[model samples]
Target: MLRFNLLLCFLFLLPGKHLFAQNQTGKRYKIDRYNSIYLPLGEISFADKLVQFKVGNPPPIKKYRDSTQCLHEPNYRNYQTPNFISLGCGGTLTVAFTDNGFMNLPGDDLYIFEVGPSREAAKIEISQNGKEWVYAGKIAGGKSSIELSDAGIDNETVFYFLRITDLKELCRSISAGADIDAIGAINSVIKLTINADVLFDVAKYNLKETAKESLDSLAKIIKKVDKATILIEGHTDSDGDEISNLTLSKNRSISVKERLLKIFNNYEGYDFEVKAFGESTPRFPNDSDENKQLNRRVEITVLPPKDYYENLINK
Candidate 1:
């Protein structure tokens, strides 16, 4: 996970809107304040116009997605096996997804998942027309990412074909060459919010049974991307003592992180952090139980790989 430099703003009074906290170490944190946009939180696995895919022929014909254990389609929502287009030396796999052309974003535009720990390297290419190809770059098979911006594609330009040519040898069985679990996209998404009620039980830091299932799905989707930074923050209604409220919020966030860790513990390169906002920031007025419930929750924000934000500096 890449770190970004946030501007240091003081603990100014925004009244009921936001609050910043200072730790014993003198670092100011903003887990308590948030922008009230109507966006769903937790995980993001966006689906675009995916048309078709082809595996280079020694002919098992179909590859991973065809035999998917994914409970959901398009997004591949579940922690299934590395459903890849396993290729051997000189083998290739190609897919087509439409948005016209991938645009520039704070992060990658495409994500390709493969067997990890030991990875396979592949040559990547894109095409506006099936016959014409443009080399985007090379990707090593685990959770390899692609930003069309890095390939000189203009924003909003719709180029269709995504071709991955294998360049590595099979490490395990010969049939287990480059195992690709899934493919996804990245855009200008900087934050994702999940409703706390969906993740926790009332007055509990432990996840509900269903919440664990939901998080498992999210973990599968997110685990496909490389270099992810998971930030979990908890919030509460303004009913308890501020000190205790802070503790509750912190615990709740940690709860969510713990669930994710259950599924993601294998990815040692990813970063995870938990923070607390307590009752400082509320999404709705605490005028009723419904509003208070909305305020009392946890938030998870994933900062895309550092290369995502590097677009600004490169610009």
Candidate 2:
């Protein structure tokens, strides 16, 4: 009886083979064209079965995998220090030392330093005579700096110095050596000396050809410094009506600016400010020819803003 039941089961499985063969019939399939093989019906079969595995089913994967197949990483850590300066980089530095051997200036002469490799900590020091040194402070990375204003050194013919002290355990090694990359000293402020009489034509808003020489000199002074600004002021004698004088003075100031623009060829980054006082701010009583000449002229003064100058020094 058991053998008869087994035969019945085998017969039941035969129909499944016929069904799989029917599903694959008339289906043009190619596994590999280069090596073709025609598979006959009943040669392939399908089975539905339960799959079981031992321990170690994974907890849900927390991170997605990157499949780009690129194995290299960027080398961003090799970058080192960049160059910078505090005081003497963009412009010149002037130290005003009195005859008595002290810095008489009311403000600080601050400077910026670009710290470099060797990881050695550094400090700045100042010297009045270049013999004795006073410790300023520690300098870290780029833009670290010190100021001489709070040093309270005397205003005599003083010499300033910067000493870089290495504080790293291995001794800091920079691309540059231990010496300062630059050194500079400040000089006394030089006031512009202008003669108004030579600056313009008499009773006219135009600058005289003779005044070109003076204007050229003024331009030279301006070109010597960075971020310098100019103020062109116009004044007139009391000989004319007050209203006419005011208008003339204003025109004169404008004319000066125009001439400067022409002379400088309208430098893109530079600027000038123009103003007219007319007969308001007189240099003299305007009674004598000399006094009238002084009043009739236009004055051009070059001034740098305190903050801007300080920034230049500290940069």
Candidate 3:
């Protein structure tokens, strides 16, 4: 059975709370925050979903098998408090970034917060889709960060899944293998999701009158960035005809792009791209009304500034 955090999983599914935007400071040379784009370390920035967890040959006791401990931010004390999960002798764990994904940054792209003094090692792999993975190097207990810069992946690609398999370097004590506190995508983009119901009327592509205020406020935040690429993607529920749904999704994305562009008409610091996935990319199954509502959304993804990234790469 796949172990997961019930509360954390439920909270992330709520509308407007799905994707978060990070607050970038300085020259974008260094981000002070972790996985979340909207909030800092104390907030909900880390991984939210625990896809798979298999205890190693000599697994830890039942108390340490609680996978929920690895859900949010890192909170492991130096052998004082037991706030992390143990991956047994040679167990494996896989996590999903439901809110944000990490991309190919110039520096380290991922950080694994581990506990214990033995410094157990785990082989790390990342994937855009959970089925196909790319070797992303390894992280020993203390040496917890890894870079995907040399992973032979396109810089524009973003990865959402991470699979960690213990190397079985150490198998002593109740908390065997690698003890994990949290996983962070250091080089990630800001994601903001808006519900389609709030943006438009049923079966219509025009912007709702009430949505202008929210969009305007959202634009104010986007305006603060020095330089970036903004992506607008539209999605729908599987309730309608596939072709019609695709067209609706496309039109809705264009509508949002037009409004945002008008807001940024005089500014040249941002570039925009639009995509429509229709019912192909649903956050939840469309069996219920609530799930359908969640599926119908317009996602706005903001990548880090190009100039800062290039400078960091050359450094």
Candidate 4:
């Protein structure tokens, strides 16, 4: 079985929690011993790409109108700070975690760094792909966190994209709407995505011969990690019945895991886990052929070692 608690302490420490560990190199590391999530800011990974942005009817000043400002980590320190982007009333913005993503864990899975004192709120939604979204509730201005489990989403689900729409609750500030500094994943994972069509025939779980190259490349990447739990999740389109789709997804994930294990037979410092979501979690709606193809895929999430963030913080 996979250990979910192992990475919890390393990912995001509770409001006053702290962890200290010493590696073989006699180096001590600290993950997050600070107050709010923004303390670690640029040190750790956060949403990296700005996918889409639309200013509402009442736009913010030109200084705070740059959508790219919301990319990466939050840099807003005070009301006078200009590091964040302001979405006008009823504005919307979407961001992507290119290198890492968040999955449901013990507590809050995501956080929003919405600066200012107005307590502006935003309708927050999450997605595996950028198209289909799951309402994960709202972030009430300032620095707020939301648990993915609260939305009744699958624990095995990992989201790469996040969409935030300004509720226009408090548009009093000069920035208006919601001033977003950054979005961070509390339960973060290093993700690698591969289209299912590349690995199998139509509706089949068996790995095609062509999958060898992809798996080979994946294995090489996995070997580079010092220590981690590897999660192999399989997903499919909604063409088949629920049970059949679920079984197919499970077998597909198992197939991928088995192949990777063969290469890692003599390998150490890693634990492999498999999960299947079938049509339960679609990155995109199955209405179109292209979208269906996009939904049929596999996501490999690499949970960092217990001391992964510790090492990162120390660096």
Best by TM-score: 4
Writing each residue's lDDT as its tens digit, candidate 4 over 1-315 gives 146776675544422111112112111222223445422212244789999999976888778888988887666767676788899899999998886777776556777777766768899998999999989878873547887778887877778999999998867667988988877776777778899999999988889999989998987765444356788999999998999999999999999998987766634455688999989999888999999999999998777554445654576
CA lDDT, every prediction? Answer: 0.55, 0.43, 0.76, 0.76
lDDT of 1 by residue, 1-315 (tens): 122222233333222122213211111111112311111111233223333444433433243434232111223222243343455444566665432123354445665554433577777787766578888776763436677778786663345566667664543443344555444444423344567778776667777788887787666555444455676778988886898988888888888887777665444535687889998988899999899888987765554445335544697
lDDT of 1 at 173: 45
TM-score of candidate 4 on Cα atoms, chains taken together: 0.61
Q: RMSD to native for every prediction? A: 17.9, 35.1, 10.7, 10.6
Q: How well is each residue in 1-315 modelled by candidate 2, as lDDT tens digits?
A: 999999777754653223222223111122122322121111110111111111111211111111110011111112131222112111111222221121234343433222224222345565554457776555454433344554554543234333444333322122222212222222222234355567665667677788788777776655444333566777787887888888888987897788777666665434578788789978789889888776676766544334445544586
Cα displacement (angstroms), candidate 1, residue 91, comes to 44
Error of 1 at 132 (Å): 40
TM-score for each predicted model, relative to the true structure? 0.40, 0.39, 0.59, 0.61
Q: Show model 4 residue runs off by greater than 4 Å.
A: 1-34, 38-45, 141-143, 190-213, 219-227, 232-269, 274-299, 304-315
Backbone clashes for every candidate come to 12, 19, 5, 0
Worst 10 residues of 4 by lDDT: 16-25
Error of 3 at 14 (Å): 26
Q: Per-residue error at 75 for model 3, in Å? A: 0.9
Please say which candidate is ahead in TM-score: 2 or 4.
4
Better of 1 and 3 by lDDT: 3
Which has the higher TM-score value, candidate number 3 or candidate number 4?
4
Candidate 1 backbone overlaps, count: 12
